[model samples]
Target chain A: MVQASSQVWSQQIIDDIHAKADLGRYRIRGFSTFQKVTHFDDLTFLSTGLTRFPLEGYKEKCSTQVTLGARYASEPLVLETPVYITGMSYGALSVSAKTALGKAASMVGSASCTGDGGMLPAEREASDKLIYQVLPSRYGFNPHHLLEAQAAEIVVGQGAKPGTGGMLMGVKVLDHIAESRDLPSGIDQRSPARHPDWLGPDDLAVKIEQIREATDGRIPVSVKLGACRVTDDVKLAAKAGADIVVVDSMLAGTGASGEALLDHSGIPTVPSIVMAREALRDMGLYGTVSLVASGGIRSGADMAKALALGADACAIGIGALVALNCNRDIPEADFESEVGVSAGQCHHCQTGKCPVGIATQDPELEKRLDSSEGADRVANFLNSMTMEAALLTRSLGKGDVRSLEPEDMVALTIEASAMARIPLVGTNKVFGWD
Target chain B: MVSLDAHSLSARELNQAIKKAALTGSQITILNPQARHNIAVGILDSCKIDIDGSVGYYAASLMDGPEVNIDGNAGWALGENLMSGKIVLTKDAGASVAASMRGGDIVVGGNAGARAGISMKGGTLLIGGNAGFLTGFMMQKGRIVVCGDVGDAVGDSMYEGVIYVGGDIGSLGADAKIIEPSETDLIELWGLLEQSGINDRPRFRKIVSQKKLYHFDNLERLEMSAV
Candidate 1:
């Protein structure tokens, strides 16, 4: 039997369908039919095509270019950048992963952040702009590391597991992590959820001030807050004098136990951004402070969309692993058999011995990853994303990401459109728009 | 011994001037500065310096190599990240003191704050008075001496180190061992304090980490299972 192409249509069928459609009937007497176009004059001389969109386009004329990327938050003490690397402790990954991310960040002229564990020599060496994280664990936190990083962040919370401390079990807490964090090798090292001095917002502010004092004014101090009530918490951070704020969405990666991940706390990406923006706007510091969005940023499109939605930059965690060959090259069946799940159901990364070894600290397995190659791949991915963003800007008839307005974006579903406050396609307005 | 009176300048001015000295590679002494936080930050060099007043937070953060002396009370973090140098605090210090010192000496004349010498790798901390809670919480390698009573959880979760408390210790850390004070402990303490020109010696109780603390508790239990 001959196969029929989906694009194929007969003349009789086309005519029958056209006759049944009211729009087709209405188009028969449209204004374009009244216009005469010759090869010399071209189709441009149509009578109905005399539309003036001001100069260039509606957006170029309506919107002025404010700053793009994250705005440095002086109060909450975070830097200006839309994208940042999430915290991947030294014990979680081998030296290769840290070096790769650091080199990639340096190549891209972006910042690389440290995790709760402590400062790694390779990470510090590779990163040009390093933001050292000081968690309740105080692993590698020292006045020296703080000064070396040129910036400091007090990790008040994480998205995966809130109201609980972080546990770097003895298995993962190897000799180096143990030595750096000053913990014995084989026992579980628990980083308390709350700082000894920090009780709440008010106390947290004082502690932040103390850290700032500890480091001197040279290093900017920032707060990494997990999204609980994004608006309220961000507002508090702003009021508390954080130079920048990192909004970790609920969908962000976690290096914690399943019980902590499922039982504790987290908030989705979209609403988190909305509330954070609202909080900044309410305080009249929306444009003044930079907001770095983390969690579930898969592609450059996602990055562009987040930027358009007011994220300074998007931070990636799992995607970074994907770039480092987390699930690549393995036989699909072997991966399925070994992990006891198909590639599609592979969320068992919390277990350090990932079949691909991307999350493990084992030397033999970790050696499978080459830092230079992995860094190049990550760089290539980031470059591609930047190119995609440029193309999106070009499509919208704009030059930079800042020109993207809420009007330029539309969501696929009505609820999403409402939540994002963008117009639905063909509707030309928001859901309740007049 | 260069006598530079820092009392003539404000805390900010004094720090700027002394840090400028570090930049100029000048070995100078700061006399009676009574300086506050952010003193000598970003200064990594080898110089002999002295301060005669109570200093504030991060006295010598990431201090590379310079002999620093605090003649009075230090607010917090006496010699954080002392890369290679000597710091003598003649008075009490605040919390997280010497949180992660790589190589250096920190001598405290009075009580220390909570989590003092938290992650000291290679350094010596001498506290004349009591040490607060979680002293040497995650100590890797180093020597910490508290002349007076220590608070709860001394050397909790320590990796490896020698801690000497002249008075009563609240408790040994999870993996820390309470060893009898060794002569080596007294010698090191005496050497550090005496080098800094203190030279005061008192009896001390020694504590060190039991290497087994680093193993995974659950994994160890599983490993011990008989098939």
Candidate 2:
């Protein structure tokens, strides 16, 4: 091939953008298609479910607008996209990390959630729409704080370790976190698994009512649940009058807690989405309440896949933290030496002594992170994911991210295929398909 | 003496009296109270409430600013979602005594039921006697102290908080540890006992979680790793 001038190459790149001015309908065939298969012709079905069938007479219809973004289970709270961030506790992350996540989520027009560790003034300052989580640990809970929490979530459970309490190690407990949580500085903070009131569903309803009355019905309330009996729990939550339901998967990120990591319960994200959809449909509350799925969603494709499986959106905790330069700038050898893991296995961030120091509370180590710059990186990553999602939607012949569906995905695991009750890619039969 | 027991008074009427007094600014003293769930639920104003007898569930759920005292035993979630106020139980308390309480002080003279002080965010829970199973199970912030024995699964999934127990702990639940009580814990517990007029602070064994087991599962093999 003949070498082209640098100017010509630049022009070609510009021309590519113009040529595909509407990149929504463009596909990359195998990689972008369901099952990663080349034989598939209907990419939309692979990405989004029947939503891509564009209502009949589309050519005659002038307005064919789809509800773009994630819908909340509660009436008033829906997000603009199917990709969002999960709650990462203040005690688990440094102030800089919390600030960075808040700023980026704000920039992305998505809500950032605060974990049970309590709200950081920095987080509140950086974020506009904050989703305050009320977990088994009622840290940072007060009338004034409740008033400030415009969006509230009752965390019934998380996927990483369902039915388990949480811990903020003394190592991560700085003076500020300690004071906010009213614990001895540098002492372990233990949170119980169950909420004090309402042992089961019936009690849960009463608690929900109490919370609603506490907020004077101004804020939308949702329930965050782990993906265990996802369908049943989702239905229960809907029956309990939840505005939104968050389903966290087993593989979702944990700051530390290697002990918990070694032993805990939570379902994977993919199966959880299907279960949630079924629950919502059974309850006749689909699209009425928002469904946010979380766990191991690393990219826009993963988010798109979840939406297709019937989730309104996906929330990412580990992915966002990782994108915030968590493990950056450190050599593989140094990481291995410091964290006692090889480069590839360095994801054991549960120790809180991050080799890069972004997740640690040690003052000397925390200095390594520049909050503003880290925030920019997170924002950039979110923007990048948005672009990728848009491109995937376009390629799948849909205009919005919701157009993506389980039909666009093929089971990477047989168990996943069974749990999701979806067909395996390149196959005509599902687990019980006749 | 108005023998207005919680059992006789409707949840609405009983609450109405407390609400009216709490609103119009008057002290409401109740005698022989019983099972009056939501007795002073969501009280926003400051008032003195004295219940001479035992009361039912959610005795003062979501209390904002009030002082409630129960002379006898109380039921579950006595101050379930308390935001502010002071609740004192002269006798024992039922399970989940102070679940998801935001801010407040709950002092129980006798033992509390299972899951007492579960998910307490901010507040102080002082139990002069034993505490049943799962005490401070998932408490985020705040302080919980049991002057006597604490039942099994104490501090099961706790994220943040300190638990001081004077007697033997049945078992250390998930993520929970047995540590030396800190100076602050000692001082705080003493102050709370004094504040609640309990006046009995003995050498207590401190049960804490090191935050290593951030999650738990009955299926998975438990790992006792200290990070």
Candidate 3:
């Protein structure tokens, strides 16, 4: 008799069920998506051969400069590079990590964002340009901080967990974190998924106006959404007076999110970007409101692909953490003793025992990461990515990164072709382009 | 004293002018307010603002330091998210008044609509007349005093706050119970009543949170039941 394999009852599924049964609790983790899905790698750039002339790499110049919030604000955020740092709160990461990210952003002439826990003074002081986040919970929100920010992002949802609220475990809710959020220490903090002030799109308009008034129209206001209903949400955000719309896809990282939400919610980044661009174009708001694409963007090639798909800029969160040595190899004994797992195999950010010290508040563990060293590493990573994107732009015979349009790319797979609205390789047929 | 007419200027221009005057600590007064919304919103400086007529939504919202006196009624979210200021409404106020206020004093001389003082952090809300349903809903840390009767579901899902009612309360919300007021609470209530210029002080019942909600054990049970 031949041995049989069961597809319905896989080993991984059985292990997961047994783990849940033994623990009697839902699993929590950091980062996102170990499952393979459609991504930017499925698309290939059509470099110059006959139709266009390629620029010289060393002598010729391809500008990477991008400006956000140009439509509404008197002072828009002008970035030297198209890459920006996405929001990651202080409670989720150590102060040293926040400071390092801020310093690196300043060094690269880009903007760093504050997350749901509010602005950290050290981050604000280190960064030359900062975007403040106003989340649904409004934790640690201050009108003065809004005035101080260079730009503001009104967060409707996060990519990893779209409909659910945020959770900070008791271990992460230390005294300072609790005080900042105005909650008691040693208790789990669960933030509401929806804003208490407004209910729908019309109310969102009023809230946007209120924020505009608060800032005296000096800074731009952006609306961020999880990539679920990309087209309709983008249209609504544009109509609601958003100067910029950020689409965070399912591949985005989180500090502390439920396992089910991270795996099962929101859409993929590639299709989300295409849908958002189409929506804005249909509404005649493509150029009026700048679009930012984020979630699982790991390299300069990905950045270039997103820009070609109509994103004015790209944001990186987990990639930035990895650049800051989030999973760097350490001594196995130390890793095992501290986190109960090897360095590269750890995802226990909710436990607050991060081995690499990038996502922890413990005093001893935090001391392992030096702010200057971390900043230098991140700055080098960003600079290299920018260079790669410039190379890609020059090869496509484009003088500016933003000029590499959708016509200059082709999809390697049918699903990618359908989702990105581009023609598949060796064929003139563009799927789903009707 | 500087007087401006709301009918003559747009809301933006009027607010800019008000901010300019407030920078020098001027006594500003407005005429024909005509239920204008967002009047004097986001004012950060200390100034005395007198509105002769009714105002609309978010009057004095995000105000840091200012004394606003509204002679007529106010629309929804009066003094919402106020920080270190005082708003005195001489007539009825609309729903969600003083919602999410951080630190300030909001006084309503007449009835207040539903959801007053919702998610209040730290402030004093004194209602001279009846308060509608869901008063002090999700209150974090603040003091709400209703001199008149209160409607149903007072202090719903409240985490930590103090609610005092002079008249009858229709129903207590989940995780809320009537408790005896401490000396400090009594003194605070009396001071608020005096500041609001209410002469008749009825015997008030204090309501506080039972601290039952917001635990992981309860949340796990809810998740299990849902499954």
Candidate 4:
């Protein structure tokens, strides 16, 4: 008798359970879920027809300039494009990769952020505008670096692993990464999930004041949060005097994260951006503090969609890695030999043996990526994204990308309509708003 | 010499004045500090600052080279992230004193609140009296010498640091172990005690990192350890 293909317990589920039982530990990997979920793809732009006049693509110029941290900062982050590179730590990526990211961001007139391991001097020197992250672990946190930064981001949580501290496996904890973080070489490092100095939101206010005072109120101070309780967290950040609120949704990528967190934690970017916008608007601070949307933001279309939903800017993490040939085709035998997985099927970033060399610290693998070539690739990707966003903005008859409003967008699905608070396709009603 | 009355000036104004005075290598004195927050913050020059009265939060925070002498009590985070400076507090200090200090010396005359010398990278914190809970918590590299009793959970999750307590210890934190001090350690402790004017040489207990908790070799080992 022929067996049925559609079993009650799928082979994937069965394999996952068996794998957990065998290993006795949850799987750790890079990037987020491949599961089909609601995202910005469920939304479509309502480009100009007869009601709105579309600008000529070649003749008319669409501005994508954005200013972040204008609320309290004397010198806010000014970018030529609304798309920026999100934080990725030095320990997770090689020094060459970090330098490439910095150089690429600088070439595009954008900002690159440092992550949990602290600042890398090469990255700092390469990038014109650098945003330093003040993580809970306080690893490599110093007043001098804080002062040197164009902006300081207080990382409350990351979208890939919310409510959990950062983890760097012993394999990647080489000499420099270890020394910069003040940890012994070849030791697994786990950062605290919470800041040692402060406990709650009230304490956060005091900490923000301290950071502002430390920077002499010159550069902006941002509070970055994973997309959990978006409305409440954004409101709290606003009240705590954060110049910018970076909302990273569950779809955001990480160098290393537990499978449990990546699959079953936090909300998606589509709803998170809407909730954050509504929160800021309700608090009467819609235009005061800038909102940066991140997580699974792949293309310029995603950037335009985010801007229409009221994000001042969109940050790309995984997309930037992809641009740097993260999962591109390589020699299948070489990939298998390095990561024990075939090319295009690799997610073993936690293993410190990346085949394409974008996420590994091993000198042999790291040498695969040339910094100048990587920077050129990143720059090309950024330029393409900017052009795509500009195309969308000009088609909407908007002079600036920031002027793209929710009225210019329509949801393709019911859930998208409700979550985005935009009208459904070929309909006048937005489920939640209408 | 520069003299400023903190009562008439805002914290920002006073800090600005202090910064300006520090530029010319002048001796600055602040009168009626009245527990003002962030007094003499971010001082980067080699100068001397004397606070005649008690100071509020973050006094001499992120100080690089200034010698800050507080005649009265200090509030939270005194000399926070201090880099190459000397902060002398004549009276008690609040929680998180000298937190994350890199290179400096902090001498507190009286007792201190919780989390003294927390995450200290490289420095010397000498407390003439007792310290509260979680003292030397997560200390990476530093030396904390307390002359009086210490609260519970001393040196919690500490990586590399030496904490010497002259009085009784309430409890040791995770991965923290008491070790017998060497002759060199005793000499160093005695020298620090002498400098802090701690004449009574109580039996000192030394705490250091266990180092085993830093990594997980395998899944089964991690599970067994967790259990």
Candidate 5:
């Protein structure tokens, strides 16, 4: 008898099709992509032994400090570590989660971004340096808030749903969330894909100027693009006078998104950084205009690999949330009974019934995660990540994380070799590219 | 009144000068404006600024409190994201006039380019002449008074707010419908026109959001079962 299951047609795929057919809409879920793309794990650093001596972990001072957006703004973002909390709005993540992220970043002398939901007052008060985001939705967009921000990030798009805007299910669009966004309660919010004022790149230049003018050029302005056409987008963003350009890859996390978009759209982090770095290099603006990478940055190894590939700094989303007990099963929550999936497999943030308190709007669920405790956990994770990156940098005989360049690493796979433009391991040749 | 020559100073220099001058609530005038971009931008204080010639993109944008009078043709995004204050344009204005303006008043004496008053959150935009395409797109609140004809898809995807068109409507946008203006609404609109010093008030037609596009049509199993 023939095998009932085929290799191409997995049960999960079949289930997805059935669910879509029944629902008459694309699947919606949280977290990032499940696509097995080449990532930071595919690159390995060539640590020093004979060519140079490695720095001692106990004695050597391997600085992880990075300054971003120095090209235009008088006051650039100064951080002790490269990793900062990326934008994940209040509507998407609970207030407790935002507060914890802010508190965590402040504890580590890093920055926390106020994502799509505008600057939550609680987060702003908790965060020492907050990146105020200007999204297409313009929800709760106040010029007064723009004045108070350390830096401003103009969001062109997100990696999870590249072409589309933010999606918050009606369940998550509670009264306060709706009130902040100036929308009616219980309406499923779909943010506009295009900015209201500016249209194209030329217009974006003027818009950047407007932002600079609005803030008196005191803080740097960053243009955050969902990584798709990385080369051209990066060039355009730089030419448009962005102080920093953030390349958010497909692996970036989201609160809620159409499952099709998460799985199908955008490029992975490995190639995106290479393309963006080369794009800036072509314009002779590589180091002049800062490049920030955000996507599936999991550990210190990933951060170190990305820094070596040309990312000045890295922004994290899901990893930080995980430290805040996002998917963890606590004693107060029942994953199987509440969300139908176990703690590790659940992606039900769109449902507003999160098993962990990080992603929900419900009062009882939000109570499960203590902001102060979550802050401690996240700060510990950040410290660990910074040490890991610094450890690898010192291993490469480097005193600073920024000194770890592409020549210090090689790709483990042929796909990675081509995408990262680095030589393959044990081979001088870079595969698939001359 | 202090006057600065636009040709002599750089864009940065001119804006900085304006900011410095606006601090003292001084009335200032710009000479040889030359259609420069970002003129008198970020002026937060309530002061009078007169531009002698044409202006370029983002003219008088991101301002909180300043009454600016542009004497010639204006470029795109005139008075964009204005918090409070007023801007009067004497000639044709480019696209996205008063775009995303939260509060205050903007009066364009001539025709306005496409996307005039797009995504307007609050305040009043009075276009004395015709307006181009997609005017008042995604407008959350406030009033747009277009005295002359409007191009295609006017009031497209407006969530709330009333667009009073005095002349012909090229066509209506998705989820936009024209309705007879109430006497009180017309009286209020005409009163605003009178305040802006526009003499004639044609037969005004009010366009509003049908409110059908507010929410999605369907939901998933988890969404349906969610609390």
Candidate 6:
């Protein structure tokens, strides 16, 4: 008998091949990348010791508020916290989940995005400030909805699956979702990769102008890019006249995606922020163009690290989903029976049998999650994150979150030192850059 | 009637003025447009607008209910995302004319560039002259009537819509199939052309979705059961 080596071809790789042999195509799954990369965890905060004096962590008024996209728009998006919920489409998520997220954002005085699936009127009513996403699919995109938004995000690409469109199985494409998207029901929907009208950055510039015109120049226009070529893409987007540029790294989550893209595409979140910040600073548009970073922000520490890496604001998806009990074992749901996996191990969002009811459109499963209760939990989570970030800012002797700069942090790992462009701990040498 | 010279006002100022005029339901005329982008955008009211010269990208776009007339040429994405309106263009239009229009009638007297009526949700786009490549590409639910020839890959990957081509076909797009039009479909095409004052009786071929790409080929046991 031949011994199978795990390095050359692991058991999981063999199983993946067997599955593809049976399925005849690339496998689809959900959640963020399974491929481990250097992340925010690799960076460590250097609190006030001898060089700086620490403020009272409990009492210091460390402001977490941030203003985004004040360059061109008459009104910019102001959030009480530096963290906001990222765009997760209604079709990809249950309407109940969308409502809860909107309500939670409103509770925290932060912004919630309308995602790819247009504006849910309920979500609009729930969210005091909403960012309307103009995605490639243009699904359920209405000018009236555009008018209702506080900001507009033109999604050039996303971090989860860059250069490709989104895919939602037929099981989730219910009547209401279908009607809103103008799609025939019960068809596996693959969203178009390119915008219907515009093509390149030049065309994107014109499209931004059109959006500005559509909104009567009231709200800011943001350009969201998947962090594939962060430097060049950021420069082009800023040159294309984006008021805000969002660099969503490969750490981003998705409702459904080809497993290949999840592991193989785009740079990690650490480098994505550093590169995007440098891109803006190179063009002298660093402060003028608000930089929002997303992908794999699991906690307030991650958000703090992102801010330290030069991201003006951070967007969260999987963290918020976890707060909403995504992988939690609820009494009514037998995750093993329904999804053939344990609660914490499940990444079966593509199957539409989400035991927690956050990702599923099934009415019976949807009953498991109460929107109001879910909103409360998410609100609490957002508040806790705010406090933790403020605590860190105060510990660093910074009165405001914006004052938490790269100089306040050091890299724990050599990879992080290079990617974050910060000095390594113990030795004052910056890797790769030095 | 109110006449606003495009030479004097920026696109923002012109649109703001147009909105103000749209409130009172008045006729607005724009002169010397010089192909400036984003002219008369986001006017969501019942009114009439007339442009004397060439307009640029997104001319009369994102409108709900309005009748806009353009005497000269137009740039890209003319009448984009128009909900319910009538856009009559006497000359040529650049790429993506009437893109993503929901409900409206856009009539182009001259030729249209590539991607005309791309991703149209619901509307009727009538073209008197030829249209360029990828016409009716990814059309969801709408009707595109072209009286003359179309360039390569017309009606590519249309989900649920009908494209009536009166002249020669270039090539079909992926998941696009050409089917013989019914008598009613032909009559509808003729009526739309006549409504646009084309006055030409031309036999047309209809293009529709093959639906082959609607669903993925295979799924796992859980996905199969969930569906």
TM-score of each: 0.75, 0.70, 0.93, 0.95, 0.96, 0.99
User: Per model, how many backbone clashes are there?
Assistant: 28, 47, 0, 0, 0, 1
| Rank ordering of all candidates by lDDT, starting from the highest | 6, 5, 4, 3, 2, 1
| lDDT, candidate 5, at B216 | 66
Classified by CAPRI criteria, candidate 3 counts as: acceptable
Residue A295 lDDT (model 5): 97
Sort all candidates by DockQ, best to worst.
6, 5, 4, 3, 2, 1
Candidate 3 vs candidate 4: the DockQ winner is: 4
What lDDT does each candidate get?
Answer: 0.66, 0.69, 0.86, 0.87, 0.90, 0.92
Model 5 lDDT per residue over B54-135, tens place: 9999999878889999999999999988989999999999999988888899999999999998878889999999999999
Report per-candidate DockQ: 0.12, 0.25, 0.29, 0.35, 0.55, 0.81
Across residues A298-386, which tens digit of lDDT does each residue of candidate 2 receive?
A: 77666666777787777888778778866565542267556665544565444556666566776766777778988888888877767
Per-residue lDDT, model 3, residue B85, is 83
Per-residue lDDT tens digits for candidate 1, residues A186-294, read: 4555566655434478656655665554444556667788877888899998787776677876666655443434333566666677678889989998876667677
> What tens-digit string does per-residue lDDT give for candidate 3 at A44-79?
999999988999864588899999998889888899
lDDT value, candidate 1, whole model: 0.66
Predicted structure with the largest DockQ when compared to the true one: 6
Global CA lDDT of candidate 3, please? 0.86
Q: What fraction of the true interface does each of the listed models get right, in terms of native contacts kept?
A: 0.23, 0.27, 0.14, 0.27, 0.47, 0.77
Writing each residue's lDDT as its tens digit, candidate 3 over B129-170 gives 999998988787888999999999999877787899999998
What CAPRI grade goes to candidate 6? high
TM-score of chain B of each: 0.83, 0.87, 0.93, 0.94, 0.97, 0.97
Over 4 Å off, model 2: A1-75, A188-190, A259-265, A330-337, A340-345, A407-419, B1-57, B69-75, B81-84, B88-93, B99-112, B115-227
Docking class of 5: medium
Selected candidate, larger DockQ, 1 vs 3:
3
